[model samples]
Target: MEIAAAIQRRGLLFVLSSPSGAGKSTIAQMLLSTDDGIAMSVSATTRPMRPGETDGVDYHFVTDAGFDRMVAGGEFLEWAHVFGHRYGTLKREVMKVIEGGRDVLLDIDWQGTQQLKQVDPDIVRVFILPPSTEELERRLRHRGTDSEEVIARRMDRAASEISHWAEYDYVLINNDAEKCRELVHNILKAERLKATRRVFLHDFVRGLIG
Candidate 1:
């Protein structure tokens, strides 16, 4: 009988978070679309689905009770309440993707990133910042998706979120979309070459010596 090694080799978790209007989601989408080997971990949320959002694709749109059941079942790697909606990443799905040797990209907040790091210390956390507070507010208002009060709330939250930028392993200032995308791609390239991830290095060295 053949035996498999006990080692559980997996791809890295790439986490990117940012304040609203900082363009993290756009960059994440771009990265995932461009990189065939990387998949985005769609979160489960206790929020009503917006137009054009498919179930289990954009998100696992669930009710509050369903989300609670998942939490009770130990299904989430990290869960958090954002703007009154609970959002969580399913542990099983993410693990399956990673174990399949495809990197998983998580678009979450700083709190969620912290929880993920606790679960897997190999997670690479990236935080995106707006060029300036004024620019951030301008972008928020320009979107015209929210009312005056809601926009004000988002701006206030942005300030607090930006304050925690130092907590991330990498920081990208989204002043130019293309430039920020390139920087994020560069970060991913550098991370994938780390010694720990290059498990065949020892074998390669042995071959050279022999």
Candidate 2:
């Protein structure tokens, strides 16, 4: 049997953070479609569902009271107020996936990433930036889901979000979607092969030398 197949490896929490309409979500979908080992972390949110979003898939839509109760109960690994709405990741859901040796991909904002980092320092954080502010506004308008007011709000917030790029492990300029996706995929592959993450290799090396 191959060494990779025989050895047990631990999984990591892979995070993707970006300003709205900056291609983080698009790249996340691309990765999900191509990578079988990683799964999206469906966050619980108090925000209303959008046109094509599914209940449990896109987000776990919850009432404000329900979200408050979960927060009081310490159910979330990280929670943040985003765009006047509350969003959070359930601790149990993420723990189950990662403990089973499967990666969990998080599409969240900078605040949530900071909180998650406090909980798990081993997480891999990646930030995506648009090629230009004009291009970002264009992408927001192209989505056609948000109103003019919301788009304005997102544009206003983009500068603040982009300022936090220095905090991430890796930062990518998403000028070309395919190229950016390839870069993100390459980062995942390399992180998975990191020496610190491959602790089981110690035992394998001992066996070979003995």
Candidate 3:
């Protein structure tokens, strides 16, 4: 049998998207918390600050005029208007992080993922889904923050959002949080091993052969 080629490690751009109550953000947080080499992409938004939110942390809160200026300058890698608010990722920041030999993670919506893919097809897109509609409703209600009317609206929106799961490269069902996190971790590890991304591998192999 022929010997398999060894691969090299390379930085990656990871995009994780999901509907409300699907646990995408939770999983993303866990991954980042566990991996020091991965950086979360901070988005710029036109939405008002919620309780305990800080500018440049949760988001770079900006006025509509500022957002417009950034868009006109083509500074955003991807952006979308969601729930009547605009959110976007800065292209330069993400590039800088990846170029520094670290993986960058984007917690965005389906629209933003699509836009990112258009700009960089190498982005690894993963979609998270709740196990079931009943389970999703239960999780939403369990939050205890939303009123009944708000919860109902969220459940309705979740159905429409999850229908686009097929558009993602990987679909993860959040049945067990630990298992789901492992699945995402495996995907990231595998993507980093792809030959095209690991350009240094060829040189190392040539050195060994010589």
Candidate 4:
């Protein structure tokens, strides 16, 4: 009983992926709001700042030269260029949270997820899916942020994204917000108990023998 309470773990890197309108962001927000043990991963980017975005909270802004330096030094777990701007998962940033025995949540695409797994094979991956293509398109348009043309392009991109669903450890459809959130919460709970994550278990089990 004492061992159970004192069992320390090397925290998990929780990767959440989905097409643009599949509700992964909403689910991530719900988890962050309720769970104190998990924190979101703030990626570093070379993109210009937008209005009201904090330098460190939203992203760690860097210049092209600095980003190149980081890449050369082997500092990023994963890095990619999107439409000419560069973004990366900072090696130190993730370790700070994970070393403190807390989960790190990531909202990334399938390509980023693959790159992350290559660096840390212990990472837990989940993919969210929309109930239907029509529903996905409806949600995208209902937001009223993108034009019809953009929505059509996004729908096309969604098909390509969904093709990688099989790469994830868990795939769930976002048919209902409440249910979707609950399912993700449960998955995190299960992943936390995995044998590899519990480094203290070896000593705990050893004590049981004597």
lDDT top scorer: 2
Q: What tens digits encode model 4's per-residue C-alpha lDDT throughout 158-203? A: 9899999999999999999889989999999888888787777788
Q: Model 4 shows how many backbone clashes?
A: 0
Off by over 4 Å in 1: 1-10
Candidate 3 Cα deviation (angstroms), residue 104 = 0.8
Model 3, span 122-182: residue lDDT tens: 8898999999888888888887867798788888778778888899999999998889999
CA lDDT of 129 in candidate 2? 99
How would you encode candidate 1's per-residue C-alpha lDDT over 40-84 as one tens digit per residue? 988999988987789989999999999999999999999998877
Best-matching candidate per TM-score: 2
Candidate 3 lDDT (Cα, 0 to 1)? 0.86
- The clash count for each model shown is 0, 0, 0, 0
Question: Model 2 over residues 96-178: C-alpha lDDT tens digits?
Answer: 77776678999999999999999989999999999999999999999999999999999999999999999999999999988
- The alpha-carbon root-mean-square deviation between model 3 and the true structure, to one decimal in Å, is 3.7
- Give the Cα error of residue 126 in candidate 1, in Å: 0.8
User: TM-scores across all candidates?
Assistant: 0.91, 0.96, 0.90, 0.88
In model 2, residue pairs whose N, Cα or C atoms come closer than 3 Å (at least 3 residues apart or on different chains), thus clashing, are none
**lDDT of every predicted structure (CA atoms):** 0.86, 0.92, 0.86, 0.87
Model 4 lDDT vs. the true structure? 0.87
CA error at residue 204 for candidate 1, angstroms:
1.8
What TM value does model 1 have? Answer: 0.91
